[model samples]
Target: MAAEASPAPYADLGGENTGPVYTQSKGDTLAVRGYDVVSYFTGDGVPVEGSQEFTVRYEGYDYRFASKDNADAFVAEPAKYAPAYGGYCAWAIGANDALAPGDPNVYKIVDDKLYLNFSEDVATKWNADIPGFIASADVNYPTHAPDEHFQD
Candidate 1:
């Protein structure tokens, strides 16, 4: 017997891509990930006064919130505030000359750990080696900012 096929795409990124989630309700466009104005997370959730910013605590030190709401309202929007890519290191993807976005599904939730990765593809590649592309990019990314990893 053969295995059943999944209807979803291999690389969904939880949304259309690594941008944000939006919905057309009654012919109106609404930002799903809250009304913080910034498409930080996966998008298409709800809107809170200050739930638009983020502060990913990973790799030992606390990465300061990039936005005011992310830092102030994370407690209220934990899932809505965490980065999509597990926070492996966005700069690394930008450096590798690959445009990769974080994979919400390919995430690591540590009791006191900040999950991270290069890109969703790289994360898939990482399965081959626990510390695969991550270690590689750490060595070559500084020389190049490749935003081509997460191509639609």
Candidate 2:
């Protein structure tokens, strides 16, 4: 028989994927909603739309880029561009211990690590105690890392 589908969509691709991939569920619009992850750090703190032509696949998920330079930067240092908590809401990870989709536009960088949030409100709260929240999320992350998204 085929393996049972997870109540959640989390999958451990193991070495096959090279690392953790963002939850690219079937028919999901795009990775990080097609926003250029590199743009958040390399230029003005804004979400830049990525093009389909300039794309790279890492960890079995496709990340689109606004330019070839951005795509190359990601290929060179993926950890520097990929968001923390597997692109889940940072506040939800620390506060509620939940997995919520992070809005690519609502983001922040602390200690050179990118963080995403469900909304401005959650980002605000997450900003209140960045260190504390980071500590909490750091602990919770490993437990939840294997799964891309959680239903409950």
Candidate 3:
């Protein structure tokens, strides 16, 4: 999904990472698997490529947006647009409470929050117990970083 980051358009954003928990698989790269975090909420939940024309660097990682408006919206409220569990797989967060890279294409929006999973199979399991799993994820998320453990 157009995940490359461009340095020029991000001066407006205070160059920072989204959060301590945000996933930067392979050590360094763009956030949210390179998908536009705002699109999951505003659009049909389908992963969309973010354009370099509209980008921001929050916390430390860079995020791309499909348009200036979307980028502005994200800049206004980063926590609202950022994914839960450090953009790790929601199902993994709930189940194993361990770290796994969430597939941008496989996601669900619950309570206006964007949730992602490692795969379609895992997402199915997560969908079945949204409330229960979220409870687990909520409790387990803060203590550890998704990348701390090698296991998925």
Instruction: Write down the TM-score of every candidate.
Output: 0.31, 0.80, 0.82
Evaluation by lDDT, superior candidate among 1 and 2: 2
**lDDT (0 to 1) per candidate:** 0.36, 0.74, 0.76
Q: What ranges in model 3 sit over 4 Å off?
A: 1-6, 9-24, 146-152
List the lowest-lDDT window of 10 residues for candidate 2: 6-15
Clashes of 2: 0
Q: Across residues 1-152, which tens digit of lDDT does each residue of candidate 1 receive?
A: 99985332211123122332212222222222123322234245332333212433222112233355444454444455444332334434434534343433344333322234445675555556545444564454444321222322
Q: For candidate 1, give the lDDT.
A: 0.36
In order, what is each prediction's RMSD in angstroms?
Answer: 14.9, 7.0, 4.4
* 1-152: candidate 3 lDDT, tens digit per residue: 88875467543556444233445546664777567899887856667989877767766666788888888899899889988876888888779967777888888889989888889999999989999999999887776743453332
lDDT of 3: 0.76
Candidate with maximal lDDT: 3
lDDT per residue for candidate 2 within 13-57, as digits (tens), equals: 222332233454643535687788999998677879888777666
Error of 1 at 62 (Å): 15
**How high is the lDDT of residue 136 in model 1?**
61
